[model samples]
Target: MHTDLWNTCLHLYARPGVERACLNLQSQGLDVCLLLCAAWLEQRGVRCDDARLKQLSDCAEPWQREVVQPLRHLRTQWREASAHDEALGALRGQIKALELEAERTVLRRLESLTQSWPSDQSQGDCDWLQRMASLAGQPDCGALQTLRAAINRA
Candidate 1:
């Protein structure tokens, strides 16, 4: 298993079906970075509790809203016009890169937040992904399961 959340996400995302599943979840208004963090915490055996969940949400939501979303909105807005405009396409690509970096920043922040939490101490009932999914909205169970299975495989 990857030792860091970023690498874990990289590995999981490269796995078959994981990217699609994540996109599906994202379409349901879930933050993929936050979900990825949930998978990491679950794998690390960190106990999932209300306080921890709130901490994760608190750390992720603001940056995602204020930083990542704007870049994404701009990038998506340019997708069609960028197809025909070379300079716009280049700028759009840069925005995409910024968006990715913003996500990485949030992932790193999440990792730092949980760095002191002990592993292998989670109670048997801890299900970070399910809990996070439920909080986000009614995300597809199959998508959540795909992420869960990928994490388990890793």
Candidate 2:
């Protein structure tokens, strides 16, 4: 729920190449939830590296690596790849698929985060859910609506 975590998740999930992002997050000892969140963040074009790590709400990286330097090598290749529309589209599709997975993961985690809250924080509950919804990219309002219905039932 930390902004850094939220922002990181938003970017990680949205990044163009999710498997690498996921692998990096995993190597950092982040839980699947956080991995899902990072994947979400990357999907949104927010890069997470040592420079940005300190800003994360969850700023604990168990396995530190100076590997961003090498990983960035993909940028040139990606630029060259732009010439091939079919390959680019396929890669984008893969990114979309990873984002969808992270979205579903976020949705599943919502209930637990909600239930574990103290009643005194009721005023902020909806706002938190909205943020989660936004991070999930639920523009069709489907996931938000489902979450609302689920909470109502409880």
Which prediction has the highest lDDT against the true structure? 1
- The whole-model lDDT of each prediction reads 0.92, 0.39
TM-score of 1: 0.96
- Residue-level lDDT of model 1, residues 33-122, one tens digit each, is 989999898888888999999999999999999999999889999999999999999999999999999999999999999999898663
Alpha carbon lDDT of residue 51, candidate 1? 93
TM-score for candidate 2, please give it: 0.27
Clash totals, every prediction: 0, 23
Candidate 1: C-alpha RMSD after superposition: 1.0
Per-residue alpha-carbon lDDT of candidate 2 for residues 1-154, written as tens digits (9 for 90 to 100): 2234444444434545444444443344333343343333433334334433333322222211222222233433555565578787577555556544554445344323333323333233233333432432433344334433432332
Specify the highest-TM-score model's number: 1
